[model samples]
Target chain A: MVAGRAGGEVMVRSPGRFTEISQDECLELMATTTVGWLAFVDAEGQQLLPVNFVLHGQDVYFRTMSGSAISSLADGHDDVAFAVDHHDDIYQKGWDVMARGTTARVDDPDLVAQVAAGARPRPWAPGERDVLIVLRPSVISGRRVRRQ
Target chain B: MVAGRAGGEVMVRSPGRFTEISQDECLELMATTTVGWLAFVDAEGQQLLPVNFVLHGQDVYFRTMSGSAISSLADGHDDVAFAVDHHDDIYQKGWDVMARGTTARVDDPDLVAQVAAGARPRPWAPGERDVLIVLRPSVISGRRVRRQ
Candidate 1:
């Protein structure tokens, strides 16, 4: 029983469907996901990295490579936490979203040309990413597991 | 231009390939990855969730559902952080791993029957997962981004 990816009919988690999403469906699923995970704390402590973001309305941008490790958090502790998710594991369904707040370093220049005229994460790694990192979220949460 | 996954024919970022992966190849790639992301600190500061783990030897197991939110961290503060990653966004290449100590609750039923005899995260979400979160790391790190 499969067939799902925005068209419907994929089952396996049909009990109590675990819903709890809103905040404009968690910023419209973090503006159409593009890889996420940026939970910081350096010097070898708590960490989770893997970024490639863009959501620029309520803030949540990304771009790194100043020696990556989240660009050394531009100098650490700017309160973090940013997560985006997706899971289908053969139809168990999925959706998860998280965003806490604080993390700046866009170094103004007309907001980096309005976030490079938006499109997507667009940094397939090469170098000179121009370190962007921006979070701004105060709080936004989500959850979902379905099967009607 | 591509073709990787341990066969060796992928190139893109050739400047010293950013290597630094050991600890037995980061526990053999976290024992064959099965979904990861768990970095904590609540009271609304930092958080990242997305579990489904299993890699017993050096510890790291997961299963939650007893009020969700990672079983409310089995009653808070046990020092967390866990991550597993991958990226090949058209051969930009990637690899990341992290784990930094503390987090327990395996309830000693012979260590949950020796972690239910290994292999796989096996929890597609439903309910009554009986909470079991163990991350005994003491700082394990990794990095990779090939083409050297």
Candidate 2:
């Protein structure tokens, strides 16, 4: 296995056809996309929901409506995972990037102002998604696969 | 909330812009795709991994290496979630379908033979993915978003 490190994230490669992507590269891939899946454990068990996100620096941000399931992620439950990837089914090649860490509802006025000024994430679904949630990942990892 | 039922699956809709997709429609949508993300809790916490899957009857099946992280799902841990969706970034419209259930390795000779004879899932990553895992969802639900 080959491993690379960047900050708190690590690149992992097993003895297979897939190659591990460096943390820097993982973040780059994440920045190139706006859609990802958020995995969290709720009363019904593990759930994966699709969301539109924006990457700002090392943090990920998304908008949700108040009183919604995703908006409740800010209630101090930190065990969450966000992942983004692109795949060419016809070519059978793709890459996957995953960020794991705690989630917090962005309530700080200063930070909210900065988010509004910066690259803010927009929800694809209509309605009032006034609540902004941020995911600060403690670990980021990714894998790339090429046609063999 | 508007709810619809089909067998063990249900369609859920909250007071939001998105509408709930019927269980039958969800399954039909699933059959049109071959890739999805699988969410499960391991020693490290919640994880989502992309997989190439095939829907056979009412079950979902995927292939993985024997010692890979996914292959370990057969060890009696039933808390797992699988999701598949498609979105048009330009149109800002899409649909999402999720399946929650227990996972088990298919070891029955008859079942294995049937799988070999029926539709078999092919792994996109190059490797000897001999282990086959099946997820029989207890709850299958979905949501659809349209340009408004």
Which of the numbered candidates is closest to the native, going by highest TM-score?
2
B1-88: candidate 2 lDDT, tens digit per residue: 2333333222233333688999999999999887899999998778788887878887988767778889888675688999999877
Candidate 2, residue B2: CA error in Å? 27
Cα lDDT of model 1 by residue, A7-113, tens digit = 22111121325688988888998887667788877766567777767788888877676776787775545778898877755666788888877786766656655
Docking class of 2: incorrect
Q: How many residue pairs clash in each candidate?
A: 0, 0
Off by over 4 Å in 2: A1-16, A119-121, B1-16, B119-121
What digit string (tens of lDDT, one per residue) describes model 1 on residues B15-128? 324678998899898787677789887765577887778888888877675776677676645679888877655666778788878886666655665665563435554554
Q: Over 4 Å off in model 1, which ranges?
A: A1-19, A23-25, A28-49, A58-95, A98-112, A116-126, A130-141, A144-148, B1-19, B23-25, B28-49, B57-95, B98-112, B117-141, B144-148
Candidate 2: the clashing residue pairs are none
Give the CA lDDT, 0 to 100, for residue A68 in model 2: 72
Q: After superposition, how far is residue A53 of candidate 2 from its true place, in Å?
A: 1.1
